[model samples]
Target: MPRMTTERTKTTVRIDPSTASGEREALEQWLDFHRVTLAQKCEGLDDTQLRTPSAPPSDLNLLGLVRHMAEVERGWFRRVLAGEDAPWIYSTQEDFDRDIHAADVDTYEEAYATWQGEIARARTLAADRHLDDLGLGEHRTGERFNLRWIYLHMIEEYARHNGHADLIRERIDGATGD
Candidate 1:
């Protein structure tokens, strides 16, 4: 198969989620807003810069966060919601932290591609499902969750990681914003 090229946007354009939209639309738009926010944080950084740790004690970096989010998207939307038995792209159950700790300059573009692909698949899987529909698989606690809960959790997940991305970006080049 041919490799997919992801043309990095110099500056990301994120639309505000509508205030008057229905529950589903509002949730999706907010989730998308946070998604673009994370991408914006990584904009204009090279692989070396992307792989730079936020601090000596922490291995957190923009690239690692991107890869981690890809895994998150796959786990929640594919493995749980859609019940697709999809294998992980960057880590395994035995060593899930591999996604965050294994960041390398060589895997920069591949990480972005994998992340984007997972996001696309996630959107597809959620499109036809109603907000109240329960996922095909249960959460780690063995409790089933609905699409609504997944969207909210994903939004929270991105929001938290995007905060880290913001700090990492600032540490790299002193750029900062929403």
Candidate 2:
């Protein structure tokens, strides 16, 4: 006989994708859901707690995640999509992981603010563009991706990092939820 076990389902207060009426709307809603989920995971935590790493030899933390996402948002929407000459906000050529490994409690407010700002900018950049619209910039492989591809990629990126955020938040204060 096979062993039986109970599976747990976590509760979340994210946007409902089913309510979205179109392809673009659904993508936006899902991305927003992940973005909010990341923010919610970092809520109620002190600066020090937010900066604490998941474990030894691992620099992953909530604060770093916010900074990293801000960089990502800027890279995809501002630079790639808009073809703007925007520079890195947190990372540098010498330290690419500066956004991740250099998490600082003192810059908590600035980091979150930057992330929110990037999100707003991304929305504005994509608002008037169609899904099939190609980006003004090309990927490192010399290929350009469409706005639809960027949206899907961003959603995947946030989803993956949000999983990390869930683990880090749980380890930080025993908080757990989806």
Candidate 3:
């Protein structure tokens, strides 16, 4: 599952081939829904509250999750899928979990800005490609994939992270559901 930051938000899941503006529209709706759910976990909190570690040995907070998900979004859509350079947002690739480590974020506004920027780029890529279009770049193992695979993989990531946020929110302040 994709790692989640915090917060839940409104979303509709109905995908009508006729109403789906396009494949990108359907995929982006689910992606946006996941982002909104992550935002819901962080609502009504300050930087200190947002950055507080939720459990022992895990400095995971809603803020960190936002950052991490931003990284994930960029990695899959921009870097891996879209063929762009990674911003190296995290300190270490050896530990992907580091992408979500709780920290003293300067402000909630700034974190959201970072996430929004990445999501926008992802949207652009999804818009420009067809469901059957495999990115020009191949994986390290020389394997290639079509846009259809990317959407499925992303859905898996979001579902996993949303589950994580559910547990973390309950641990932080008994917040859960919707």
Winner by lDDT: 1
Using TM-score as the yardstick, the better of models 1 and 2 is 1
Predicted candidate 3 versus true structure: per-residue lDDT over 34-129, tens digit per residue: 777777777666566666666778777777778777777777788767877776565476776666764443455666788888888888887878
lDDT of each: 0.86, 0.85, 0.70
Better of 1 and 3 by TM-score: 1
- Candidate 2's TM-score reads 0.88
Task: In angstroms, give how far residue 167 of model 3 lies from its true place.
Answer: 1.8
Error of 2 at 24 (Å): 0.8
Q: Provide the global lDDT of candidate 2 against the true structure.
A: 0.85
- TM-score each candidate: 0.91, 0.88, 0.77
> What is the lDDT, from 0 to 100, of the residue 134 in candidate 2?
94
Point out the higher-scoring one by lDDT: 2 or 3. 2
Query: Candidate 2 on 1-178: residue-level lDDT in tens?
Result: 2122232233435676777378988899999989999988877776777788988889899989999999999999998888888899988888998998653333666788999999999999999999999999866577888999999999999999999999998898798887
- Tens digits of per-residue lDDT, candidate 1, 15-120, equal 9999899989999999999999988888887667777889989989888899899999998999889877788787877887888876333466788789899999
